[model samples]
Target: MALLEVHDLVVEFPTRRGVLTAVDEISLHIDEGEVLGVVGESGAGKSMTGNAIIGLLEPPGRIARGEILLDGRRIDNLPYDQMRTIRGKEIGAIFQDPLTSLNPLYTVGEQLVETIQTHTDMTPTQARARALELLIEVGIPAPERRVDQYPHQFSGGMRQRVVIALALCVNPRLIVADEPTTALDVSIQAQIIALLKRLCSEHGTAVMLVTHDMGVIAETADRVAVMYAGRIAEVGPVKQVVKRARHPYTHGLMGSIPVIGHDADRLTQIEGAMPRLTDIPTGCAFNPRCPQATDRCLRDRPEPMPTEDGQVACWLFEKEAAHV
Candidate 1:
């Protein structure tokens, strides 16, 4: 069974400008031990999608439509008190900013112990020991000594590891890591990715990884979902989406990446900037920038349609033979 399922989820914010849709009819699933990558440019709603799933979407932003199911149980729109039991216990979140997520006033050990104890029946000493073990498991040095350190004392990478450790404290079936490596260096980025992959494989943990880096998605994701202007343009297995991308937006993203073997003087780039959330185009959101866009694309929105490989929400892939 799929560990996590998000169906037709829409997140919108009411601003002075207008009702800005940050995530529009987005849907996907993650199987046990599977890593699903959500990639797009800034403001494409990748992080917002993560926030919605974990019941952490900030004020002014509300889930206007659709459902979020974890292990076949509905979680979207649940009361805050009810959702608290699920968050960190059933579905953990490793946010983009580790520093901001950690409590500066508490030691790493205290936070972890509190988390574990609050969710489980473990005694204080037992929780502390488990916290130490988790720290070491996530690659922290001298787990015994480091567990007592404050968030400010740890380096960027170490802090990220601590965050990971806290996320795993409850043995959550699913983990939503929204750009968890964004604060670390390139070398440390790889390490964190590897650690996440290893943990998922070992524990049957499903992951929803939100990032703007296509390379990171290529290396870590079992499946890829490409979002543009708050909607998913394409979704499929990693190999299919990366090598045989059907959507023009997905193609543009792959073209922009620099491969070790493929040489180019300058990286290919997608033209035009992201339209304001309050001012999304009339038909297809990506139509203004899509090279293959036609008059029909501007006149009418294309519904998400299934293809042989996966799914795409573009009219260019409408013909029966186009996807074959």
Candidate 2:
């Protein structure tokens, strides 16, 4: 069975104007030890999906509909205390900003030890040793001394490593890494991605990586799901999705990539901006920016249809033309 299965998840925010649907009936699955990359621009609902799964969405935003299943058990409806028990034990999360996730007042060692002790039956000494070991494994220098320092003392990259160590404290079965490298420099970004991939492989942890960088998805993901507006526009194997993109939005993204020999006056860009959650169009959400959009696209929403190599939610690949 898949380690995590999200079915028809919908999260909405109540506004003075009306209810805005940030995520609409989105569903996906991650199997044990597999890396599923959820890629899209900002406001694409990727992070919202992660937050919903971890039960971290605050007031104003709520789960309008859906099921978050972990190992065949439904978790979305669990009580607060029961869900708290699962949050760190069954699932771990690493966000874009390490400092925001880590407590400023506490020593890094204290937070890590607290997490380890909360989820496991380890004694204080054992937890302390494990915490130090994890900090070193994540590439933090002077694991012994550094552990005693506060979050502000570490560099951005070093702090992020500590965050990774904290997430792995419970030996979670699933890891939700929501743009974990977004706040770092390019040089440090690669290192963070490598660390996540290596640790997941070593611990047999399933990962759902939400990011805007296609390069990161191509490099770290076994499979890719592209979200447009609030719904999935395309999904399939990473290689097939990257090299043989079927959705117009996906094609536009690839066209913008700076290739070695391709010399163009300007980098190709998707012509328009994504619609606001409050002003989503009548039919296909991407029709306004999609080059291949037709009248049918603006008049009727196209369901996700199977392509030869992938699945895309666009009229360009209508089933009537598939046989021909």
Candidate 3:
């Protein structure tokens, strides 16, 4: 069974103006020990999807429709307190900024030990020991001494490592990591990616890695889901999606990446910005900006259709399938 399953999820905010749908009928799944990268532009609902899955969607923004399941059990409709218990124990989360997640007043050890104790039946002393072990596992040097320090004492990279440790403290089956490396320096970003990959592999934990950085997705994710205007444009194995993208948007994203040896006069860019949630275009959300869009694309939305190796939500693909 899939470790994490999201089916037709729709997240929305009812404001004075009107209801704004931030996420629109998106569905995907992550298997055991798999890294599913949700990549897109800033407002592409990547973080919102993660928040919905982890039961952290802020007030006014909620799961308007559809279901979220973890290990075959439905979780989207669970009560707040019940979902809280499931959050840290069954599904962990690592966000973009470590400082925002960590408490400034407490020692790192205190926070880790508290989380471990809350989820497990371990004593204070046992929890402390496990906390230290986690610190070491995340590659924090001098964990014995570092564990006693506050969040402010660690560097950006090290603090992120601490956050990773906190997420894994309860041995969660799945993790929702939203731009975990975005706040670090480029050099540190690579290290953190390697660390996350190694730790997840060793623990056999599934990860829903949400980011806008295609480079990071290429490096760490097993499969890639390209989202556009709060919908999935294409999804498949990372290599296939990266090298032979079937959807035009995915192709544009891959083309935008800079090559080391190949120097081009200018990098490829997808024309026009993503439409605002309130102003989403009719029919295919991407039709306004899609170069290959036809009259049908402007009037009718296309659901994800099977491709040779994956699925693409495009009329072009649908027509091709019909001819075949």
**Number of the predicted model whose TM-score against the real structure is largest:** 3
Which residue pairs show backbone clashes in model 3? none
Tens digits of per-residue lDDT for model 1, 244-280: 9999999999999888987789998889988978788
lDDT of 2 by residue, 228-258 (tens): 8999999889998899888899998878887
Q: Name the runs in model 2 displaced over 4 angstroms.
A: 320-324
Quantify all predictions' global Cα lDDT against the true fold: 0.90, 0.91, 0.92
Report how far residue 127 has shifted in candidate 1, in Å.
Answer: 0.5
Worst 10 residues of 2 by lDDT: 315-324
TM-score of 2: 0.97
Model 3 stretches with alpha carbons more than 4 Å out = 320-324
Candidate 3 structure quality by residue, lDDT tens digits, 126-188? 999999999999999999999999999999999999999999999898999999999889999
Q: 1 or 2, which is superior by lDDT?
A: 2
Candidate 3 local distance difference test against the native: 0.92
TM-score of each candidate?
A: 0.97, 0.97, 0.98
TM-score of 1: 0.97
